[model samples]
Target: MADALTGVSRALREAPPDRVVEAADRAIRSVLGASGTAVFVADYRINGLWPVVDSRQPEVADQAGQSMVQRCFSSQQPVRDGDAGGRCRLYLPLTVWGERLGVLMVELPQEPSEEVAARAVDVAGEVAMALRAADQETDRYRRARRRERLSMAAELQWELLPGRSLSHDAFHLAGQLEPAYTVGGDHFDWSLDDDRLTVTVLNGDSIGLAAALLTAVTVNAMRNARRSGGGLVEQAELASDTVYYQHRGHRHVATVLLELDCVTGRVRAVDAGSPHLMRLRGGSVTRVALDQQLPLGMFAETRYDLQEFDLDPGDRLFVVSDGVWGADPSGRETYGQRAMARSMRATRLQPPTEAVGTVMRELQAFHADADLRDDAVVVCLDWHGSGDREGG
Candidate 1:
């Protein structure tokens, strides 16, 4: 098992960017004595899985196979089934540090023993790590994951994201954006350092490429400050000043910056403009009120205030942009007034990763399945609290 794993890792390291997946497939088949191997990656929308090779698109006709693959991906578990001619097919989820990349399907000569199955799971983990590393070197995996062409603005926004989800012993965090292919301004980002976690959400006050650019600048400014050992106040101030100098009061971005002490469930925040916060504790959901400051870039040298809050273990917090809560489809009722809360309640049992997506789906349904008029961002955080902490 060790030799096989080493061979696979060596192959991945030696392969060129575009050939990484092919190299992995060949190595797995040779090392594991498998008849066939394929890597399937979840599409951009997370609605379908597409083979990394030998297929131009996801197989829409193969409902059974698709379901099996989806199940493995969603549950982060290995699934086994009988293949043709007494062979056994194994679907192993390709996940790394809580991120669901896709699945690795292997067709073995026969059903494997428990040890072999365990080895396959380890191999899948290695492959996922390779894929994550390859992302910087090639766009092959990214292209395969996209079912449709992305608008320039959407491309920029996607590139600016820290990631779709992150997990830790203290918290589970996930976020999503609506109008995936053409998303404009709304964006979210986060960083974790030891027991401290920082999260930011931005709602650019513009549309199309302009909004994308605004968001990009603001995000980078905040990131720069954060990376320089700055706290919420510094991040907010630096971002505000940068945006203000760029647009000179003509453009602005509504944002919420949060810093959490993982051990104590203490949170400090800076709320600038439209992104709103809500908390779910026990069974009830209520808005988290913060001092609203001027949107970034609204004026030169705008001073921002920091607000403090605490979360009990098992508490879930959501930060949504105005595009979500203020969504008024065809002049009807706004989504935040009721539908959003109902959606949150419905998905309370789900992990943050799944809950974020479910909430976005509900938002779409509230829009009557119409394309969202504005870009929307939703971020969910579940605080599990730290084990070493004395009190909740």
Candidate 2:
């Protein structure tokens, strides 16, 4: 009997909060030979303690409820005597830090004596200590998780942000990335060389270990493809080919590439399966419906197409990733092309970063506090060949 009680004490001391409560209830019923046991926690209203776990007698289990527990809580003392109506009912208040936390009730087959009352008190004290220890553990876990998330968020932001903007007097370009996690698959890059201004975006819907691999492949493939001897069309094809060959036809990816001449303000683009690119011109938005090609590495028979256009001084071109299209409000209403285009038209006068932020905020509000399902990227390119528009 002493050894069993020692084991119960050890369990209460070592277990977490949930386990501590469970162990306390189990020990009382087993050691005291109680017919039923209950653990009640005080409600926020402070008027009562509600039973969390109720072990009731088969004869009167249905009749006994929280109200029956009122006298024990009201007296703020243990009730164990022949005067009680049932076989035996013992109520011991579970207190901590000079405050009553709740009540622990034990129903006995006979009136409990002084020996049982003393043991019940000891058990209640152990339960209180266990509850405190469990609270401490829970608090520690919450702090650790908060710190970890902050660190992850910081790392993700640092990696995705470019060191500087890729803008000059002739042409201006900027982009924004908003991930639903610490790391996301939406990425855009722009490198200005002596020959051409290379621009690319890699939109990956990957996650977990696969997402990490996709990110590495996307970054390395873009760098290698841009450095290869090629135009935008050739570079995009090279990137697709590299991914396909590297994955051995096991994985798939989506990519786009563009080369703009600083002198002529001509924009050449190669779309390799991504969301439609929108062009805002003269107070209106136009969806440049490039051909829908297969994602990279899907199959050997996939083909790509290239398109070009002359950029007016005030023209704005927008490239979006699949994350935007995937986010649906109430899981039904999509922030589709029409909505995105409208947002584009409305924010045409805003800077690239602000425009993207506006769109993201709108999507967030539309979802009504739901979490973003995917990472999103938005890149805006504008031609300033005429030097007629204000910088934003």
Candidate 3:
């Protein structure tokens, strides 16, 4: 065990940026005495798992939905399965603090002794942490995980995001953007400060480079407002004002900004031109009807209204862009609010991360072969509170 870690440390210290994942794969496989190894990262869009490193193949299909990988990731436990021919496969999930980084698979030449199995588990954990740290230091893993090259617009939107999911003592939130490589100006941001959680879900009307810049400006303004101690209305106002003056006198941004007192289950939000917010509680979904407001940059002096509400325990709030609700560009068909409601209710029990994926899949299936003419996104926020506690 010590030797395994020593080798990993040496690789970590000397491995070049391009070979980090390859080195990790080699170390894990060498230490396990395995014929080969593969590492598959879970994609944020839930389109499929992506192979970041595999000794046998240059690229591999998304195998996360496969029985073994699913079992390991969902159960947060290692799985050992042997086939009828006595060939053994070991699937170990690499995760830290409940965030799944990827899965490590090893093809054992022979049944491992108890000691070897224990060592494999240790190596899995170490690799998970190493990937997380390496991801920050190098783009090797990022490049490997992506299925295709992103357009400039999609690249900007991707750069503006804060991963796909987050959780805290009082809440769990997850979000996904569609048309991964071609995604335009659809993005989400959240910050957990003490007991307060600030969230922003944004969509831009323009596409390509224009949509990307509008999203960037809108997100930065919202972040500035939040960090400056602005309330929900103020946050929306700042973003709107910035876009109004900055977008060549056009209202190019639509958004919903939220400030939640997680401890108290209180939420305050400003909804502009984005799709109406949907709420799921007790297995029922309802569309929130707030006063209509202009998209950011639409009106110079527009004062955004704040819709204040208290959530019950086990309540989920969902936000989606117009692209999702109106993916069928032809006015003849509608994804419709009721259909959206049904989708949310059906998947309310899943973790926010899985819930959004299912919803997106359903929506895409409904739209069939139609392309998303606009940027599409979904943000799911789950609050599990007593609804009676007061924030200190």
Candidate 4:
């Protein structure tokens, strides 16, 4: 076991930036006496599981749609596939913490012992960490995964987001953007520092590349304020000041800035033209009313109100960009509050990660077969307060 661990570590650590996946695959196959090996990386941004490296056929690496990979990814467990009586393949989920990366495939010469299966799981995690590093340091693997060309604006917005989900002892939050391949300017970001969690929900109105630039500037300004120990209104103020002066008021960015005391479940918010902030409790969903102010870049003297509330255990908070509800205030063609209420009810029992995904899928079904789909975003937070009062 020590030798196997040392070999896997050396293979990934010593490999060149461009060849991490290939080296890991080689090491896995060698250690397990497998006839072949492969790794498929999931790029949820584009909804694809593309092949990075494969020793057998290149066709086998793109098997994300195959039943085995799908089962392994969703269940987040290792899958043994001699049940179908083919060549006896094993699929392992490559995941760390709460984040799901992709699938690892190992082809055995024969059915392996239980020890081999256990060891393969450990190696899969090391490979996942290496893949994360390669994704940042090298371009080869990323370029291979791009099945479609993204507009320069789309690329910027995609990078502005904090991955698709985040979880910890105090809260679980997940968010997603729609029309992911060619988004306008919809991004959500979050940071958990010490016991505080700050979140931003933004929607920029500019089109094309301008929208992307607007989002980039606004989100950074918000982060700067939050990291500097500013509250909700201060974050909104900084974002507005940056956009108004930098863009000369040429564009406006709508947003909701959220600050949570992760330990106490106390919630505070500043709304600068965000569409809605909904809370789900018991079996129903209701809008969390807040004082509204002009969007960033709209007014130099615009001031925001800091809204406050306390979330108990089992409470959910949702803030959405206009794209999710549509730009229409008239509510004729848009996804209306009634529809949203139903979805919140349906997904109330799911964890935050699954809840956001479920809502996105339902939104797509609501707009199915339509050529024009706007960029939509939703951030869902599930809060559980610290149990300091339990003894009372």
Model number with the top lDDT? 1
lDDT of 4 by residue, 238-262 (tens): 8898889886777889888888998
lDDT of 3 by residue, 290-391 (tens): 666778888786688888888777889988888787666556566755677778888855788778887887787776756666777898988878443333
lDDT of each residue in 25-135, candidate 1, tens digit only? 788778777777878998766778888865422232367777889888887789997857788888999877777789988878998988888888888988998998898
Ranking by lDDT: 1, 4, 3, 2
Candidate 1 lDDT score at position 93? 91
lDDT of 2 by residue, 1-392 (tens): 46656867887776666556566766777888877777666532234455553244222233454555555554456765344555777777765533445677777888777887788877777776676457555543222213224334334433544422354666666666654334456677778787367777777646544654665566566677667756665565666677777776677777777788777777777777775577888898887766667777676645667788777778888887877766775757577646776777877777553466667776666667466677677777776774432333
Global local distance difference test of model 2: 0.64
- Stretches of candidate 4 off by over 4 Å are 53-65, 83-88, 327-333, 384-392
**RMSD of candidate 2 to the true fold?**
20.5
Residue-level error in angstroms, candidate 1, position 158: 0.6
What are the runs in model 1 whose C-alpha is more than 4 Å off?
A: 55-61, 388-392
Question: What is the lDDT for 324 in model 2?
Answer: 76
Computed on alpha carbons, the lDDT of every model, listed in order, comes to: 0.87, 0.64, 0.76, 0.77
Q: Would you list the clashing residue pairs of candidate 4?
A: none
Top TM-score hit: 1
Cα RMSDs, all models: 2.3, 20.5, 3.9, 3.4
For lDDT, candidate 1 versus 3, the one ahead is 1
